[model samples]
Target chain A: MTSSDNTERLVHVPLGERAYDILIGPGLIGRAGGEISTRIKGRKAAIVTDEHVGALYLDPLMDSLQTDGIEAVSISLPPGEKTKSFDSLTKVCDVLLEARIERNDTVIALGGGVIGDLTGFAAGIVRRGVRFVQIPTSLLSQVDSSVGGKTGINTRHGKNLVGIFNQPDLVLADTDVLNTLSEREFRAGYAEVAKYGLIDKPDFFEWLENNWKEVFSGGAARIEAIATSCQAKADVVVADERENGRRALLNLGHTFGHALEAATEYDSRRLVHGEGVSIGMVLAHQFSARLNLASPDDAARVEAHLKAVGLPTRIDEIPGELPSTEFLMDAIAQDKKVKGGKLTFILTRGIGQSFVADDVPASEVISFLEEKRKK
Target chain B: MTSSDNTERLVHVPLGERAYDILIGPGLIGRAGGEISTRIKGRKAAIVTDEHVGALYLDPLMDSLQTDGIEAVSISLPPGEKTKSFDSLTKVCDVLLEARIERNDTVIALGGGVIGDLTGFAAGIVRRGVRFVQIPTSLLSQVDSSVGGKTGINTRHGKNLVGIFNQPDLVLADTDVLNTLSEREFRAGYAEVAKYGLIDKPDFFEWLENNWKEVFSGGAARIEAIATSCQAKADVVVADERENGRRALLNLGHTFGHALEAATEYDSRRLVHGEGVSIGMVLAHQFSARLNLASPDDAARVEAHLKAVGLPTRIDEIPGELPSTEFLMDAIAQDKKVKGGKLTFILTRGIGQSFVADDVPASEVISFLEEKRKK
Candidate 1:
């Protein structure tokens, strides 16, 4: 993995008139000001980051933005998923409005998924919408949430149930930031990187299986993984920006993943989002096998690769006592993906071959979960 | 307007794939379900309305929907601007998700602007987005809000600071519903109708001066007024859906109107949105005249016509003591239209000739308001 190779990868999300670019590189954070100035031109920026990320990379980002005479006012919040709440969104929006940011002015989201989502959503609704830039700091965000136009905050009901599809003008996926991530956090991000491969790219999945360690080491391998994941996402998102069909494929593991997160009451200490996806992806394969949609060997292969990467591949892998199968069933029923009370899962026919199975019988899912609880 | 003429006056909002028809006619409410069912096809419907409108029309709408085998569940809230709040939006979204409404399923907004704005925003964010229909009942909504894709709820910061521009699959503006509105409400709506002509249709404004009485009486005049206004809005919005350039012309009176509404604390009893716009429209003309952008004769004509139609055309017409000019100035600065601390107003050259005026000096606006306050 080399800086020269990684710096050249660019993923374009073609949204007709609203299209944008995702640049994957080793030093984009240091080059962000020049990168952003060309896109927005003469407009000021409001950089929104979390305290944790601010402590790590805010100064560098500010300095980079200043390089092109791009003066940016920065706001840092307490880090974590809880920070992506309506109150936080409101506070950010008021600051932007009070500052009288113009329609062309930029709002730079300079953290992971939480900051990216919260800031992007604010940018979308402020004065109806302003241009936004995403500088994702974590492997998970760089590979997933940052590329997609979906931005939102949590609600009393669930995660991301209330949000709009607000694409960013530019996404700077700087791989240099990944070095700051803890091993646990890095592995969580790997789950999503592995997701794109599992969704359709068998060759890519096989690649991750071989280079998983190199990716963790951070350099060319990590940048390639992020760029590949973003390109895969950009392709699906371009084809189905509103998630009518192919976009659902990107949520391959999210259905069961979301249910597990709900069961854990979203206590990241018990089970983080990427871990839920890791387990959910494995369950998706196992469920496919149970229904004769795929071979048991294929399911096992998927599970083994996740375990090799140290990701949770089963429900019991979660810490602490789990909720009842009925509770999990209720969570699945409550999933935003459920169309007309029927279960819809991105089930697989084989590795990297997924399809949206509309109206999968709920009774069947319940029975399968019951069997899995015993294991 | 006659049913035949009103039905014939369909305004097409052309936004590529998101384009939809706004049907303005008598008894469209009774035919809403059938009309909607034809477009969405085999989808369930969730009709979100207000108590006032629900008590009058929900059963008929439900029965109409059932006629086409489009089963619908309905929720009704208290009627007014207060209904358009984030808490109310959350309540509506939870209900739709709880009902397991699919992405393709339709959520019908079945009341005036408040319900339409609240429900459309809820539909926009729920599951990223869902198909929606707006059956606007009030004159204000019929001629204005329902035609455009501006869906939002008010916040502590300002009105519509938090929302998405989510267009509806269809909008049924039943002229029959206008009969239920009070004379004051009807007059308020007429202000917007007169607005389109003032914005760029001298002939249409001249026509309104002649037809104001008939428009209030409701028949051919009512439907024609609504449909024409929608067409004006459609033309502007289709050209600039995000209000970047040409669309700002649609806010001809809104900046001043919104400030006045804020001054009154949004007390509908003192001044409804339409009335606020009525005064604001008059103020806009006077300001233009004062700035030598337009003539005093043009300002007088605007005031005279509005007064004849029974809309408040002067600052003193607003009931109760007005806020200080400084307080009013704060509201204007906080306007979503203000870009980079510079006031952006739609100023007129003459009747049917308006242009976007960016960076208007705030001192000028304050002095203008001071003169108006004394009168």
Candidate 2:
């Protein structure tokens, strides 16, 4: 079903008292103040954004908040994955406290995943948690991070190794924000949009294969895809907010994706998160086929669709020299999903038919990587 | 209830799935591993303690864990309120990560409140949470901080301004450890013991007044008092784990207490937390009397009880010149408990009848402080 440019679809995350809504449409950003004022009781907000996002969207958000009689302040940090660190978290927390952001006041994150993760963490800990709102600016964040309540920072050990599951009171996913993201960045986010289909919505994947161009071009199709993706995620989150059971299904490609990101030393110039996810998704399907769990054609279909949307579908597509298989294996072993030194992966019978596989042999993963690298 | 020295009382905090037991008795520290292993699934443990606590108890605790076939590592921090800071939190988190503390593995806090708060916060965030056990080493911690899931670190803004409600899997409140405490420290903790009585148990308060020496000398009376305090706290916590409602009653004297702690710049020599609470409880009663919430005689009775126990009952009893009334008010205003810029204090009608009073007038507090200084 196609949505109009002005049509805003709402996906409600039902986490009991922690339940909240995600508003997906074109101009939610412009209406942020009125929407936030109606939903959140607080009359004060602190908008945390990066230098790039602040320049593009901060003033409009501030103006909207002021128009609604909400006192708003803004803090801009350097833009990049590097900002998702303990130092940035402490700085954000100190500033939030300095601003006297009370328990009732809101801390609005207005950037990509990095800002949402870091800002949500600060909101969670400051005064033992305060009101949090997510104005996720990228498709990756809007579809995935912002909706999950999984806020955290990267530690020396791994990404998102430290944080709390602080659910947002509301999330405003303005499709218009996508217009500002670079083509590469937008494509990176689409990898996650496509991910929903791979996880459990084969029909959505088939639809994306047919209508991806329209999704990238924007309008009704874009809204439907994002709304669908969020709803799928919300279902998983409501079932397992803490990642104890069914929620591991949401990490369909993350174990492989995270290892690839780590292999590149987290150098965005080489592989941003979603791009790593793209390669990871393909590898997951290919590896499952090697284990005789799925057909090779299913993996080929996923790669073709991802490549059609301009996302890298193979590790060889990544820029610069690749790390050795042993390094990648070490990265995989260190993934936070590891339980009791046993490797867990999201393997599939086919597209949209994934299940969490525990105790996947390290030798199998090693041989799979060795063959894939040679390709 | 009088009991033998071998009697171990258990207070269970039933917070649904987050529920746990507080074991109040002697020799609990010696059986930490056995108790923890039976409850928590993981066999790996990290013991976080203070230098003072570690020097006295680490080896014995480690030996107990080793006996249970649990691999254990210990991190000893500096002993003091100063250790409850963001820097220390980061250090502890890094060490936990370095030790490869996994989600199921337990983080055992083996000291007083400082170690408990800091270690619990780290456990709550590392890998997005792990099993945690608290072995409170002081009377105040055993009776108060260790029971509730209130984990945090102090910031420049105020105490416990950064934290999360991370409950422990088990609390080992070994009364034997309190024997190592200095007299001043034990008395400071006694103030909290008295607070449980003053808050809502007039009978407990009267009982303490009659059997003060027996409770102090340690045995059946001490276990009963500590067990009663834990039960009282657990009841409040089970009812309102997040402090959204009835739990605020538990903060009866903390508002004034925190302000006093801040006035002395959190200097332990001038006033530790429970000492400030002793004075603050009296101040709360006097303020209540001033407001006619209770009779002046009730305030006098409360002050007499605390003073009889060697706790300072008046502001003048604190060492050094106290800050001005306005300065104290500023500290109160900055308290984490303040909501929407209004003062919220735990006021009382009399002993055993404390309640949360919201929107308290700043002017009256100032006048009360001015009058208090004259005493």
Report backbone clashes per prediction.
Answer: 4, 0
**Tens-digit per-residue lDDT, B1-375, candidate 1:** 223443446888989999999988888878887788778964688989999889999999999998888878989998888788867976898789677677888999998888988899889888778899999988988889998799988877678877789999999988888888899988888888999999999999988888888889978877787888999999989998877789889888989999999999988889899999899999999999999999999999999999998889988978889889999999888787776677899999989998899978989999999998898
**What are the runs in model 2 whose C-alpha is more than 4 Å off?**
A4-6, B4-6
What tens digits encode model 2's per-residue C-alpha lDDT throughout A103-206?
88899999999999999999999989989999999989989999889999988877888999999999999999998889999999999988889999999999
Candidate 1 chain B least-lDDT 10 residues? B1-10
lDDT agreement with native, every candidate = 0.87, 0.91
Output the number of the lDDT-best candidate: 2
TM-score of each model, in listed order? 0.91, 0.98
Poorest 10 consecutive residues of model 2 chain A by lDDT? Answer: A1-10
Candidate 1, residues A143-205: lDDT per residue as tens digits? 889987999988777788778889899999888788888999999999998889989999999
